[model samples]
Target chain A: ELGPMIVTAAIGQDTSLEDGDILVVTQKVISKAEGRIVDLRTVTPSERGLKLSIETERDPRLVELILRESKSLIKIDSERGIIIAETHHGFICANAGIDQSNVAGEHMVSLLPEDPDGSARRIREEVAQILGVRVAVIISDTFGRAWREGQVNFAIGVSGIDPILDYRGSLDKQGSVLKTTSIAIADELVAAGEMVMGKAEGIPVALIRGYRYQPSAGGVAYLLRDPASDLFR
Target chain B: ELGPMIVTAAIGQDTSLEDGDILVVTQKVISKAEGRIVDLRTVTPSERGLKLSIETERDPRLVELILRESKSLIKIDSERGIIIAETHHGFICANAGIDQSNVAGEHMVSLLPEDPDGSARRIREEVAQILGVRVAVIISDTFGRAWREGQVNFAIGVSGIDPILDYRGSLDKQGSVLKTTSIAIADELVAAGEMVMGKAEGIPVALIRGYRYQPSAGGVAYLLRDPASDLFR
Candidate 1:
C-alpha cells in the first residue's frame, strides 16, 4: 500500500514537509489500499432492495448493496436517480459512498473504509514513524451539499489536527465575544487539496505547508452534528 | 481598494504569477469597497422584522436589515437564535451574509453586495487591467452547511473559471463513463484559500497558481440549482 513515501516521492526529496504540515489523502487510494471494494454481482437483492430497485429503476444487486452499507435512508429522489443515505459509519452521501468510478472491473465498486478515523490515525502514525515529522492527516471524499449546486471534498476522517477551530470565547476585532464561529479546518483543507488533486487526475495525495493549526488527538466524529442540534437534517 | 498591486507588494517583485492562476478573494473586502456596510442604529424595524426579532432574540434593528436584504427565510431556530436566510441575490447564508466582526465600530455591520457576481467581475477586470494578466476570480464567504458542524468558506461569486469540471461523458481509468463526477472547483478553491486566510488573520486574499481550469464568460448564477431540480432546500 502507498504511504507517506509515495507523497515524498511525488513531491520530490528536495521539498521536505515540516511539523504542522497537513496531508490530504483522497478516499480512492485509501479505499484501494484497505480493500474496501465490493463486487456488485455477488450481492443478492433483499425484499426491501427489490422494492427500492423497482421504485428507483436501479439494479437490484446495487440496491441491495446500498441497503447493506446504509444505516438510514436520508433522501430518495426516484425520478432523478438520487438516493442520499447515511452509511453505517455515520457518513451521509449518495449510495452510501459506493463508488463505481476508477475501479478495476465493471462489476466492482468501492465502499468507504469501516473506520475512517482509525484509518487516518494509522496513516498519520505510519507517516510520522517513516519521516520523523509530525503531521496531521485528513481523509477526503467528494459529496454533494444541500442547497448548493456542486460537490466539494470534505474530511471524512482526520487525525492530529483539531477538526474544528473553536472561537467561542475569543474576542473579535470589535471586542465582541465570538459565538458560533467554529471553523471546520479539516473540510477546508480537503477542499484546498482538491484544487491540486483533481478528480480526473491520478494525484490522490497533497501536502499542505506553511499553514498553522492546533494539533490534537481527534477524529471526524467531532465534526458531525447531533441529530437533536441539527435542524436542517 | 486593495488590488493586484497590494498582492505584488506583499509577495515581492521577483515573483510572477503565471497563466492558469486563480485568485481567491474574501467577500469582506469586496463588500467593504462596494459600500455594503449598514449602520444598525439607522435601521427601522418592520412589523415582520419586529416579530422575527423577538422570536430570534436578536436586535430588532438587525432583524429589520436582515428582512430587507433577504428574499426568503429558510430556517429559524428561535431557541438557538440562528436564522438561515436566502439573500436577494439567491445566496443562502447566515443572516444574509451580515457580519459584525472585523468592522470599525460595534454599530457598523456589513452585508453581502447587491450582486456578488457583478462585484467579482469588476474586481477581476480591475486586477486584469492593472497586471495585464488573465486570472479567474472567486469571492468567498464563510457559510454553515446543513447536516455538517462548523462553517467553511464557499464561493459566493465567481468569474473567468468554469466553476464546475463536469466529467459525465469522460472515461475513467477502468474505461467506464463517469456519470456523476462534476467537481466544484470554485468552492474547493475558496475552502483552500481559507487555509491561508485564517478567520482572525487579516490576509483576505490568496493566490493559487499552476492549476489549469477552462476559461469561461459566466457568473455564479449558473452554479445554482433550479428550485424544481432541488429536492433539498
Candidate 2:
C-alpha cells in the first residue's frame, strides 16, 4: 500500500491535494483506465503494412499503429527496423512511445492514453473536487533520445501546472542580460520520480514530496515546441 | 571550502579530485582558459552579415556562426533564426550549443571548447592522477529541444563512461519482453546536476554522489547518433 497501491487508493479517495504534492501514476495504470489495450490478433495487417513489416522488421500491427499515429515519417532503419516518427503530439520519439510490454495477455499492446492532457485535467479536476485541494498530475512514459544512451521516463501528459518556467529578461549575478528561456521543470520532476519507480519494480506510481512549483495558464502544452521554431528539426 | 567560494584559488585545487567522479565544467571556464574572446571593437561585420542582421534583427556575428554551423536553414524570425545542423562532434543541437552570455565584456562571445571530449578526458586524467582513482568526465550544455518547452542540460561531450545503456532482451516482471532499447543515463545525470548548479549561482562544477556507473571502452563520441540511423533526423 506504500507504493502503487497507495497511489491508486489516493486517486480514488476524497481528499485535498496540496501545493507541492506530486501524483506519480504509471503509464500502465493510465492505459488500463482509458481502455487503450490493442489486441494484436484482431488487427489484420494490410498488404502495405506487410510490405512495411518486411522492410522495417517490426510487428505489423504495431507498425500500422505507428503509421496511423505519425504526423510525418522521419526514417526507417533496416538494421533496428525502427520507424522514427513525429507523433500526433509533435514529439519525435521512437515508435511514438508505443509499447508491447506489460499487457495482460499474449499479443496485446497498449497505445498511449488518447488525449493524455485531457485525461490528466479530468483526473485533476475530479480529485480536486473529492479532496478539495489543488494538485498536479503527470503521466509518464519511457522515451529514447536522438544521440544519447539509455531510456528515461518523461512526462507525456501533465495537468494543473506550468511544465516550463520561463525566465526571459531576468538578471544574472554579473548584471548581465538574462535570456535563458524556459526550464522544463515538469520533465525533470518526471525523470527524478522514475529513479524510484524502477522499470523492474511493480511500483507504478509514487508521490513526490519537498519540491515546490507554481500554477500557470500554460499547462503542459507549453512544453511542446513548435517544429517550425526548432533549430534541431 | 564546500559551499560557494569566490576566488580562482578555490577552483580546481589539487585536493578537489575524487574517484569515479564526473566533472562538469561550464563553457565560461573553458573560454577563459582558451583565450577565445571576441572584442566588439575588433569585430567587423561582413556587409552580407549586416544586411542579414537588419532583416533578422540580431547580431551579425552571431547570425554568421548560426549560418555557418547550420546544415539546412529552417526559419528566420525577427530576432531568432532556426537551423538544423550536426555539430563538429557529430551531435545535433541548436546553434551547436553556442551562446553570447556570461562573456566578460560587451561583444565578446565564447565558442564551445575546441574539443569537448578531449577537454573532459584531459580533466578526467588529470584528476585521476591527482586523486589516484578512476573517474569520468562530461562537458554539458543547455540546449533547446525540437518539440519541448524549456532547455534541459545535455552532454555535449563525455568520457570514461557509457552514455547509453541498452536493455533490448530484458524481461519484465510479468514474463513480458522488454525491448527497452537505450537509456541516456549520462545526459539525465547532467540534467539532474543542473538542479544544483544554477545558471546564476556561478557554481559550474557539482559533485554527484551515491549513484554508481560502469566503465566502458567506448568514450563520449559513441553517444552521437548517426544521422543516417537516427529516427528524428
Candidate 3:
C-alpha cells in the first residue's frame, strides 16, 4: 500500500510529521496501489461503448470501462472529443475519471479507487501506526470546472478533517452577518498540494503543515452538490 | 495601500521575504485599502436596478452596483437571490463580486478593484522596493463554484508568474505524452495561501515560501474561459 511507503518517504526526506498536519495524496497512487489497472487489449466493448467510441473518437475498450464506471452521462461533446460523465461516486469529470496517462503501458488505464473515503481512512490508520502522529488524509483528483479553462485538484476523499470551514453565523470585520461564506477548505487544500505533486513528475504526496484545520470524520461527500440544487448540472 | 501593511505584518511575525516567494493577498483588504467603498444611501437605483431588486429580493442600490460592474448578465436565480454575471473583467461570479460584508459600516458595500492586474503589479512593485526581494503577487477572492457547495479563494490578479504550468508535451510515468495536463499553478497557490487568510478573521495576507515558480508577466485573464468555447456558461 502507498500508506507505509508515504511514511518511509517522509522520514527519508527528513520531514517531521506533526499532529494536525495534512497529507494530500493523489488518486492515481491510491488507484495504482489498489490494482485498479485495466488492460485495454484484454477487454471487449459493448454495443453502447462502440457507439460512444465512434462519437468521442476514443478506444472502444476504454469507452466500455468509462461506461461501467459512470452512473450517468452528462455531456457528449463529439466535436471536442470529450465525454463529460458522472461517476458512480457522484464525481462529474471527463471520461468518468479514467485516464490512459501515468500507468504502466500504452494500452493500460487506471480507474479511480472504488471506495475513496474508505481508502483515506485505511491510509490514515496505517500512517498513524507507523509515524506515531495523527494527521489528516485527503485523496485528491484533478477535474475541470464549468467556466474555467484550466483544471484544479479537488478532494475525492477526506479523513480526520472537516470538509468545510463554515462561517454562516460569524460576523465580519464590520459586525455584519456573513450569510453564505463557508469555505470549501478541503478542495483548497488539495489544490494547494497539487502544486507540489505536479503531473508527469510521479510525485503523488504533499505535506501541508502550520495550517490549523478543523478535525472531524467528515468525508469528501460533503463537497458534492445535488443536481436538483446545482443550476449548472 | 496594503503593500506596506503586509510587509509590516510579516516583519512583526519574524518572517523574512526571499526571492521566488509568493505573496497571496485577499481582495477585500485591497479594496478597503484602495478606498473602493460606497455608501448605500448615496446610491440612486435606476429603473433596471429596481426591477431586478424586486425579483432578487435584494437592495436596489446594491443591485445597481452589481449591474454597473457587470458587463453582461448570465443567470438570475431569483429564488436563491443570486445574480450570476460576467464582470467587466470577464469573471463569472455572483453579484459581479460585490459584497456588503467586510466593510466599515452596515450600509457600506465594497466593489472589486477596477483593475485587478494593475493592483497586483502595484503591490509587487511596492514590496520589491521595500524588502529588496522579488516575489510573485497574487490577489485572491473567495468565489462560489458552479457545481461545488462552498467557496474557494481564486486568483483574480497575478504578476511576476506564469499562470499555468504547461505539461502538454511532457511524457508521463508510462512514457506516454500528456496531451492536456497543464496545471493552473497560480490558482492553486492562492488556494493554498487562503488557509492562512481566513475569512472574517481579518487575516488578509499569506506568505508562501520555498516554492519555485516560472516568472512571467501573465495576468489572470489566462485563467478565464472564453464564453464561445465554454460548455456550461
Score chain A of each prediction against the true chain A by TM-score and list the results.
0.95, 0.88, 0.97
lDDT string for model 3 (A118-231, tens) is 999998998889878899999999988877768899899999999999999899877888989999999999998977888898899999898888898778888889898787
Docking class of 2: acceptable
Q: Write the per-residue lDDT of candidate 1 for residues A37-108, one digit (tens) a residue.
A: 989888889999999999999888888889999999999999977889988878888889988888889899
Error of 3 at B111 (Å): 0.9
Per-residue lDDT value at B151 in model 1: 94
Q: What is the TM-score of each candidate against the true structure?
A: 0.95, 0.80, 0.96
Candidate with better lDDT, 2 vs 3: 3
- Record all residue pairs in model 3 with backbone atoms less than 3 Å apart, i.e. clashing: none
Separately for all candidates shown, the number of backbone clashes (residues 3 or more apart, or on different chains) is 0, 13, 0
Q: Which digits, one per residue and each the tens of the lDDT, describe model 1 over residues B140-171? A: 99999887889998888888888887878888
Task: Estimate candidate 2's alpha-carbon lDDT, on a 0 to 1 scale.
Answer: 0.67
Q: Residues B18-70, candidate 3, lDDT per residue (tens digit)?
A: 78889998888889878889998999999999999999999999999999999
- Name the top TM-score candidate: 3
User: Candidate 1 at B87: error in angstroms?
Assistant: 1.1
Instruction: Name the candidate, 2 or 3, with the larger TM-score value.
Output: 3
**For each candidate, what's the DockQ?**
0.69, 0.42, 0.80
